[model samples]
Target: MVTTGDAAPDFTAPLANGDIEAFTLSDRLDDEAPVVLAFFPGAFTSVCTSEMCAFQDRLAAFNDLDATVYGVSRDSPFTLNEFREQNDLEFGLLSDYNKEVTDDYGIAMDFADLGVHGVSKRSVFVVDGDGRIAYSWVSDDPGVEPDYDEIEAAVEDLS
Candidate 1:
């Protein structure tokens, strides 16, 4: 798993940002803005919904910190499209459909106990302008969400 001070692994994934375009992680980091990558288990679930909407609610603060926020999940770009539209999510969601990105970050989970598999574990990574991880949060229990204020503080410190 990537941790604070480690260089975040770069990958190119298709975005669910309504345009369904490809976004290269390294390319975005070139802008010298901290990127907040929120990895959720699934779309439309209650907890995931609240967590994503919270980000949406705090979008201004993220913008004020000159950070870019993007939700990442194993869900397909198609599902994310509906979720984004339903929640009025302004930020994009990266589709890790193949689970390669999730696995590389060491956040992939086997949810067979819940009749699901190959889902992303709830986690967050703050990659600074230099493409090094500034903060990392991984939840053992998927029900738990990261502390938004702490994430904001991390970004605030980058300034």
Candidate 2:
């Protein structure tokens, strides 16, 4: 898996806002702005909703740190649109339907035995300016929440 101080891989995907957009780590990390790339197992799931809503509630804090928050999942763009609207999300929710971005970021999980789709494990990566991953957290279980305090501290440190 990619670790701290490593250049974050760049990719393009469809955004929930109905735009086929391309995003790169460097673009987000430019201008000394930090990026919070949060990967969820899937859309419309309990844990995923909680995680995203928590981010929404704390959007001001993240903005104060000059961080761009992006919620990523293997769901399709159409599903992402519904999720964003239903939750009233203000930030970008990216659709990694092909799993290429997830695989490139080394977050994809295999749950064939349980009949689960190959999806990204719940994880968070903080990329600093210059596209270096400054912080990363991967949930041991797909069901657990990430350490938000640690992520906040990481963004604070960048500031």
Candidate 3:
């Protein structure tokens, strides 16, 4: 699994923020801004909804620190777009439909009982401007959410 100090794996994925657009992680890094990649299992689920809404609530704090936040999942852009609108999420949602990005980050998991596979394990990574991971959090229990205060502190450190 990617940990703090490791180079964040860069990837280009479809971003859903009302509209689907191409997004390249390196482009954001080039701006010398910290980026928060919050990976959730799926969109619209109870736990995922709460976690994302929590991020939405903390969006202003992250912005104050000049950190860009994005939610990542294997959900399709259409579903993600709806999810964002439904939750009033201001951050863009990345569609890892192929699950490649999830695997690259080493946080992929399976839900045999639900017949789901290759979904992202709830994880959060703060990537500094240099493209190195500044903080990392992973949870096997999808119900758990990252500590917003800790994440804000990590981004503040970058500033």
Which number leads on lDDT? 3
Model 2 misplaced regions, further than 4 Å: 18-20
Query: How many clashes (backbone N, Cα, C below 3 Å) per candidate?
Result: 0, 0, 0
How do the residues 14-106 of candidate 1 rate in per-residue lDDT, one tens digit apiece? 999987999888999868369999999999999999999999999999998889999999889999999999999999999999998998898
lDDT of 3 by residue, 44-153 (tens): 99999999999999999898888899999999999999999989999999999999999999999999998999999999999998899999999999888888899999
Model 1, residue 23: displacement in angstroms?
A: 0.9
Give candidate 3's total backbone clashes. Answer: 0
Q: What is the C-alpha lDDT of each candidate?
A: 0.93, 0.85, 0.93
User: 112, model 3: CA deviation in Å?
Assistant: 0.5
